[model samples]
Target: MIKNKLIILSLIGLSFISCNLKNGKIENIRKGELNPTVELIKVEEKKFILDSNTAPQPQYTQLYQDSSYKRKFTFLNTYTNSIYIYDYETAEYIREISYDKEGPNGIQRPMGYLIKNLDSIYIFDQLTNSLILSNDDGKVKNKISLIGDKDPKNTEWSLSYPQYYPLTVAPLIETTQELLFTGMYAWAIPDSLLEKFHFTSRIDLSSSKVSFGHGYPATLYGSEFNWDDPIYTAVYSDLHPDGNKLIYSFPVSHDLYLANLDSSLYKTFYGGSNFAGTISSLEEKKSSPSHAEMGVHIAGTDLYGGIKYDKYRKVYYRFLRNAMSDVSKDSNWKEKPLSVIIMDKDFNYLGETNIGTLKNYNWENSFVSKEGLNIEYLHENDINEVYLSLHIFVPEEI
Candidate 1:
């Protein structure tokens, strides 16, 4: 279940003059006043049947592809606490990097695994409250704990959020020097911890400094920040592959915000549809920590599927999952269709498509990989069998 949540967060932004729908250029009427010409690109899809011969069903699947694995579809299973490898063409189960849980170097209840490279991974170990660096062979190299209080560099930039480690990162912006992280918490911030609520922070690993003042004002989008849920949902950010620009969005509104890691640039393209009126009160948004509602994309089902930056094809994507208009709640949305809103390199509104409904909302069911956008049809291709049906999306230049 925990892995399921992380999968939803990672999985998904662009630009815009008057949207045209004629001659492959779709006409779009945005909720905002910006009437700009926009290009519409069609998507092509194919599926690489994932080899399910090795396991019954995975609890969670994360993209773990590298050159060593032939650049094929590889996944890390949270259920098994291991990596599963498959052939790109054949969908055959080649190997699994299964790890132990009882050893001195082992971890219990790992929050998630970051595929830093083919070899090493930073496992957020719940038991130790540390990120255990381990090799593909399950060898523990090191474990780095959060240097919150003991960092001698700056005492003011301390991480004071309770139980901090959701830490959503921009996929394309990860570098040796820095990484962008989302600060989503439900705690009430004191005056001392105001700097900690930068919304998006640039953690420079080389200098050991947490760069502040690089985030949009939470009060503007989060409906008055520092109220109850300090770790609000509106602060979720994704990387723009064009220049690795920081991208953010409002959950219930049609507002899309673009900025930089240093907070130097700021731009917004408010492109929304007729159903964009889906909104909630600031008081209602301040739900309990456990029940905090997230980005539904003006729909009822999706609870903030974080923005995704596709590096393979220089474009941005926002997955509007299971959108159902007939109801106000998410119960009926599970049977509705999914839409991938397309945007250009400059964050311009491009086009969108209804990718159909889904049965398995698990992370294993879908991902944007080196082989284009891949979504598995669980009902058609069963994991209980040898193969799973895949739905792939590629760019069809129109």
Candidate 2:
């Protein structure tokens, strides 16, 4: 009787699987009507190559150019929570600053930036929720806490609110004497209220003040899904060369929005439909007969992003991973190739490039610097043993 019952259960499971296979069909979710084929223009060989072993595991690097277009300095963020300053003209590591000790908060994840005046360096500590200002000698001069209880509705008043998560910082852009920086306040709200969610603020370096700013409400669009559940998301913004416009990406809607401090016009580009399949019904259909969400999975589920405006090409270099295409029945999930997409400033589709077959690979962060396009991915020669690898891609032409 037991054997018969087991057979019956096995048959029922197979029947359910077959039914789901028929109903849950995979669909392609990438955006843009124009599927323009982008041909890789091989202009020149790799002119500069920095092996990972030689330098500190480079998390981020920025190339500073003088008014004459000559490279001045290369500021590097090292894995050791220290900022390494290299004089490009001298081709040497001139100084290193350690912000980990002096501040009230610990410096676990340090994102470094050289201020416009070229005198001070700002390090954003992802672990401590604070910003550390230092000099060329690595001495901490000032510290700013990004988190506070100040309510935007009551800007004049201040309160005490407990910070739950660490802060992520962006590079500071200058206008005249004042410097500007952007960051997000990580918090949770009801799914129904996600659309009204604007958990970010702007900081003025001179006054040492932070002002709450508005952000794209992604929860309004994906109301049916669980927006509260932490999925992959990032908030990234860049200042135009002239500092007139700030271009930023909000992953929830998979859209790029432009904000002009001068005009106060905050508009989203491409109607927030640049990338395909940011939202999926797979989680909702887990018990359903059809696994429709399977189609949206490309390779990685995270919304890892690196965006830059290419003046020469007149295009925006935006890179992110697609959903995992292959789902494994085995307990272990394996790595696959990543899809890199390039688009115009207006979010028009240019073309897609596939970085073929990377093993034990996980992407952390990416950025566009004066040196070229740099991406940091967790990679392993053997499956299971993974380490961070920083890859730099230079444009074919000089």
Candidate 3:
């Protein structure tokens, strides 16, 4: 089984060619010979050395904020084995809580978040197929299991592709005390399974429970058609500043969907084209697909998204993009271009600006501050070389 997984990873790496720019020149942009000035700001990097042997691989990190704009806490997921909490200001590991007392072994990628006002954290464990509750101190308090009687006709019943199994949990958000979560399931499963087990979006905490709506049915071919399922990939949701609406990213279709607290009305923003990229077909290999292409192909790419509201400009900062393309051969990749984009609250077109474009440039993570400041991590080719870039956009004198 491990060997098979390794092969899959290798194939994914070889699937596409690098998309880096050539001769260090970005497409559609002019090359300047002037001495370019780039600012370097330093952020304190405190280490939280964990028991590497015992710690599950860290898969994701989320920063939480209080209503007053103070840093609350940062949550880390160890791929379903355990959830760790760290102090944002001190950078110290606070606690580690495992969903299953026995700990995570395989197929469990637990993802979660810290709800505001609540002294507890909510986690979604994909391996054990359960929802876990933990106190602020990282102690396990309760859990909700997702696994039930399986039907042979159910797409989830077939263990052929466990990755598609509705086991990977998305981050958890809070609406008061009620917690909300989104899960993905393959479409090939039986209709009965879809009705009973396939859940695209839901809100459940202690007493309150609500469902956004049923997901589209899965296809039987178990091939490309199955990719059409709305819940095939990672689904992300964040609470609006108003606290009444939730913004979700439907990765499969590469569309951003907004759902009200009532889950009564849902709409797509930016006409769906605002978040997608163009892909061109490259020459085919003797055995590879002819239509195969490379170089930052955005169509059907995975995306990371977030929103920040600004009262001064009466606009919202919506950040969206997919993983950076491996541009090893292209000069553009060497001098990575900043693809960060900002959009209005209503999805109106504002303008495009490069966050940072310099030699040995690589972006790791980004977040918008309540004061409308954008903070991003720029890393060198080396894993340890990282810098925090603060981008403050002050409007011109009126």
Candidate 4:
């Protein structure tokens, strides 16, 4: 069984005005005075047959649209160090990109990856502490060290690994001349750095120079907060389709932060869920809690996860983890309640709908498509090792 603590934290915004569909009629509804309902868009079940006979782990999957506008997904089979590709709607096997475990083109440990295109597949090799840019043919074109020359004396910050989500924020994003991603740091970092820590890191693809900016919201800093737990400081972001803006969602705040990549300008909007309140509270302590303890604490707390934009619907989907009544079983914490807050293109709050829980779903294996949000679904007794099942959901009128 996949650990809920790890997948739940990652695997993981907006506004709007507009119209509402009620009883099959279009009605004018002001924002903040409406409730959104969940509509079953469709379901897809596709099996991936591999020659090696090893099943692909759904936890490390990414869904992307090709140049031809066809939807496809890639799965990382760490067991074989291969990535399996499949058609999103049909589940047809496309091909597999296998990499060597050792050599000039080899990748030691791939913790996360992003696909800019078929020709530009970015993989984060944790063992080497570098990012490897490869192609669908499994040929490494470029390798860049994530760690640039920084003062060893500065305990304020460091880039150890890339933190990202497959559905919303990609691990590695290539812009005009720079690649952007968030970093994963150890919890033992100094508190002073936490006060004004930058939330993003940029690597100049040409110069290989690294820089950090887009500091966390003021709410994340200050003496009132504790940085001992990764859950409290967990942040997820995505580069806007516009190519110059970045959207950030904090685990504790209800407001979605929009920052301009070209400058230090940012604005916040109220895009919280009515079912649950914004702002999370934690115990005042110095040490961190066990994984099981953290899971239980999170189940009974209201926190946000990833915020993804649905270019197809012209809206944003922000996930909210509702507090659970029974935190007795941390093992099944994923079975707790969960919902999504919808916002318009302008970041106006539309409404929200409860989509049940992560009980049978792989949170990291979800992506946005024309059909809506496609989340990988699994049955309790599911034994099919080759095929993937997805449940699609979209916001609808009550």
Candidate 5:
């Protein structure tokens, strides 16, 4: 198993004609290179309801279908060792994908995953520490173990560049076929390589290569922008539907970065001038504890909802936490506002609008679909069975 995995990794690397880092190295972006915008554009929102009462509540990590959830909803039931496909409109089960625990194509501890190929999605199985590419129907088509069979995760060594870590991760879709993995606070990494690896890296499953993405500023609240603690890494990211341009939104400073393939990095602030200013100061950041003790403390009380490109309107929409409404206020850190920021492909600020308040804002449960923005709400009509509410943003013709 070890020899084959290594051979596979080597072959994948060789297949790539050339792998170049942006500029072939990671450099600190210049000052004034990224500026937040204060301009605001208005938008209209209509609500669509996703009733979860129709079936056994499905456990899904991400939503890939349209806002309507009518087309297809994919879910993974880790406890059951199965994945399900459902039709949202009729609440009908399309199909369930299941495999034996010790079979030829079994996945263990499916930790993180993202959408791929139009219908099929990628799963990160932690037990075997491999990236599994499933068919659109949820059959495990191919399995590529990222590390060695003898536990490549806890080791303290390096063989070459593009190193693979068994560290925890949250996978996000970048290109239709590629995945971007953001390390979940790896405080356990040895000192030699503690901060060496960039926070974000690309897993080119096709080429079997791992590469770096833009790292966050190192001084924002002690965790570096990459750290999930102190400031929650509520990074809303999306790629241009046409071009694979990377768009990033941080609720912490209201800064949006446009790092395209051909251009120098561009930055824009979404809300008003006070938006970016509301983030923690350098002093406050320095004084804050590096380790997140209580909860993942995002910089501003405001949190980012989600960001997506409006394929229909040809504009970008970013959901922000507006009015601080509480779900379980008695509980620590259970409030975030519900707001949206509008922008164009050029990063020009359009306007802002406020929806109601999110019950409990979990980035995992919010996604942007072709129809509208779908977010999970704990209280729907005061019923707390966990439902998804869609906020359809109609771009003002301005």
Candidate 6:
């Protein structure tokens, strides 16, 4: 069984030619760049009612679609130690998966979770530094310590997604033989050493052996910018709909990266935003800036956000936070002009759709559905509302 898995990894490096659609026909242009063309999309709005006492935010929600086209998502309600499941289209309240806090099945402060299905759920426990697998009934099936005998002085790691630093994260990637998740580390180390750190860890399900690879792009080394800030180093990733490749990007660069599941080999493609201005840099600085100072600098900088793949349209979408102008130094981190860059399957730039500002919608919490891209709408005035609103963008040709 392991031999078959190794074979799949070896084939990932094989190159293939791709074609693009032009004038309603497929044409091969693999030798050079195709003429750049931008496409537009229309927006539609809808709402889903949530009768539960707890109001779930988009940052923590995970949307999953079944074979029958039923869209259901789950989010952890920490207050109740339960995971709430809801129907995406119909706004129906589904059942909740409740967990214990003390017994053998007890969970120790779960920071993030993944639901491959009702029967296969994975939870990352912060207290134990472990990953736990559970079922719909919340019965613990298996558990593995992520920090087994690792020296913290040399390296620190975590799977928990900080609530404050919201990133569109996939808690774990599950295959027939392995499970994978992007790892985060502390920034206390020197810039030279930190730049070489690996950002992914893979665990063999059959053997429970953990290994790390998939280092950051070479462009990250010796850069003028200070990547110590989480905002710059944070990654937004999505798995290809075919489940063979993992596509990810950093907030500091416009490059989109593809990491093969079987090998350390990877590839990169240009995916810069049309509206993104120059990203701010901290050059020739003798000391690190305060957190507030860093936040203020990043506020006026053009940075990228989460990346999503729309299987329905056979394209990808990435969030672009446009640079703010004439901003006050005292101004806290707030909403700014935002847009979504569309890319074809081959990472070709399609077009960008401006979606107003972050105040109106939550791009961090979004999913690609049959209707279009559903982004959560923020209701500032009615904080006690019992429903979740969304803005759906439908792609259209110009």
Cα-based TM-score, every candidate: 0.67, 0.65, 0.56, 0.80, 0.64, 0.81
lDDT per residue for candidate 4 within 13-130, as digits (tens), equals 2233232322212222332454554433344445555454565344377778889988877778777787778887677888888888898789878767878788988887766666
Best by lDDT: 6
Model 2 scores a TM of 0.65
- Tens-digit lDDT track for model 3 on 176-280? 656655454533333333333424445466553444442321211112222323323344455666777766544333234565666433454531223234322
Candidate 2 C-alpha lDDT tens digits along 5-64: 322322331211111111222122344454555632322112122334234234455556
TM-score rank, highest first? 6, 4, 1, 2, 5, 3
Cα lDDT computed for each candidate against the true fold: 0.49, 0.45, 0.41, 0.64, 0.46, 0.65
Pairs that clash in candidate 3: 19-295, 20-327, 21-331, 21-332, 21-333, 80-110, 108-127, 126-167, 155-189, 187-218
Q: Whose lDDT is higher: candidate 1's or candidate 4's?
A: 4
**Candidate 1: tens digits of C-alpha lDDT, residues 1-398:** 11332222222212333222222112234534334343333244333344433443343344555756554455555567676767666666677776777786677666555666756665656455455667778888775554353442443334542233443222313554664455443344443343334555455645535554343332232223323443224444676654556777533334456765555445656434322333333343444423323323223433234456668887666655534565543444456565666666665666655556645433224556766666554553553554445556765544
Of candidates 6 and 2, the better by TM-score: 6
Positional deviation of residue 215's Cα in model 6 after best superposition, in angstroms = 1.2
Instruction: Please tell me which model should have the higher TM-score, number 3 or number 5.
Output: 5
lDDT assessment of candidate 6: 0.65
lDDT for model 3, on a 0 to 1 scale?
Answer: 0.41
Q: What is the C-alpha RMSD of each candidate to the true structure, in Å?
A: 9.1, 12.1, 11.4, 8.8, 10.2, 8.1
